[model samples]
Target: MSFFTEIQTERLRLRKLKHTDWEAISYLRSDPDVNKFVKRASADTQEKALAFIEKIRQATETNSSLYWVITKQGQNQMIGSICLWNFSQDRKKAEVGYDLHPLTQGKGIMNEALKAIINFGFNTLNLNRIEAYTQNNNTASINLLKRNNFKLVIGKQDADNLENAVYELKQP
Candidate 1:
């Protein structure tokens, strides 16, 4: 199965990242609060944003990975992004990541989006395991993973200079 596929949930739609989404995506990625746990991107201009989007498009086209823009049903606004990165050739596992706009925090939007992505990973992609890592201080994310049935495997200091809590869920 193709890794890149649109997924629709009751309250959200996970669609491919498009060129037109750069403007909003740029803003989201540049937000300090939102980018705190994420690796910093050097996208300082529209051209860079477009280039980044194109790279994501190419990655999806090749089925190397998947990056999706999360939007609410009936609205074109991008509330966040859900991604499955570093896919293995064996196709048994992947690293999951997500981020939401600060304005939308505390609304359970991310929790809903994560559920949709995990369901897609296990049911659609037939992946056996999905894993996520969050900084130890990110209680919200840790709790979200726990609520989604991801067991905390352990905590370790990452090369990025943060104590990360690793969580994983295996398909039943």
Candidate 2:
């Protein structure tokens, strides 16, 4: 029932998350630099990280989400992660989420990964829209979204997280 698939771009690979990706996931979730503007629970310990991996695995098996680990082409170690989840009840919309190792930031790595995901969402999955919610103060993420042509959703807000501003990219 999973929609898991491997995606290859010019310089990167977006593939299924493996159990061995725990260390990278642990750091990506808990690192101060990476989570500075993030507002979710962190996997600060190994056990918590593993649990998260299992959660993601089960979610994928249920077709609840599509998650990918980002790495340079031919590499197995994950330097970042991205996902399309939180599908709207009608299945026309889904939220996009991502994070990268600080060392990998500013390299346009995420920009490429997101482009691929957007294509998958719109063309492959037949989605009508892809949404992103970032802290209004998270300039890097906001800029990334805008660069991908995601427009700020006027007057719409995340009720549970007032600090978040929603952005959306509709099918072309």
Candidate 3:
């Protein structure tokens, strides 16, 4: 598909990321509370945020990845973002990633979004396996992976020599 395939869950909708989502995306990518474990370049500036949105859009158009802005059923505001990308050449596997607004933390919104994305990865995308990586201290993320039947896989250390846990869910 030239565009992202939208998905809907019980209480959330996974739609393609739009330029208007830059503000929310910037907040999630820049906030220390949310980016504590996500180690990427600074998206704290408007320029960086615009570039980030373009990156996702290009990835979707090229069928290299799928990124979705997660919103509540009746809400126009994005509470978070979820994606399945970093595809293996054969497209049998992909890596999943996500981030949520700090204000929405402790709610089940992400859990709901992830479930739908995982389903899309396995079913529509016909992927054989889906994987995720989270720092050891990210208990919430690790638990979410496990709840979705992803098993912990051994991994190597990062450039900083810090270890991150890898989780994988295989199609049954």
Top of the candidates by TM-score: 2
lDDT of 3 by residue, 68-134 (tens): 9999888889889999988999999999999988888778988889889888888888999998888
Model 1 — TM-score against the truth?
0.91
Query: Model 2 lDDT vs. the true structure?
Result: 0.93
What are the TM-scores, per candidate, against the unseen true structure? 0.91, 0.98, 0.94
Residue 110 alpha-carbon offset, candidate 3, angstroms: 1.1
Candidate 2 Cα errors over 4 Å, as ranges: none
Candidate 2 clashes between residue pairs 3 or more apart in a chain or in different chains: none
Q: Mind giving the per-residue lDDT tens digits that candidate 2 earns over 64-126?
A: 889999999988889999999999988899999999998889999999999999999998888
For model 1, what is the error of residue 124's alpha carbon versus the real structure, in angstroms, after optimal superposition? 1.2
| TM-score, prediction 3 | 0.94
lDDT of 3 at 53: 95
Scored by CA lDDT, what does every candidate get? Answer: 0.85, 0.93, 0.86
Ordered from best to worst TM-score, the candidate numbers read 2, 3, 1
- Report the C-alpha lDDT of model 1 over 60-83, residue by residue, as the tens digit: 888777998999988888888999
Best by lDDT: 2
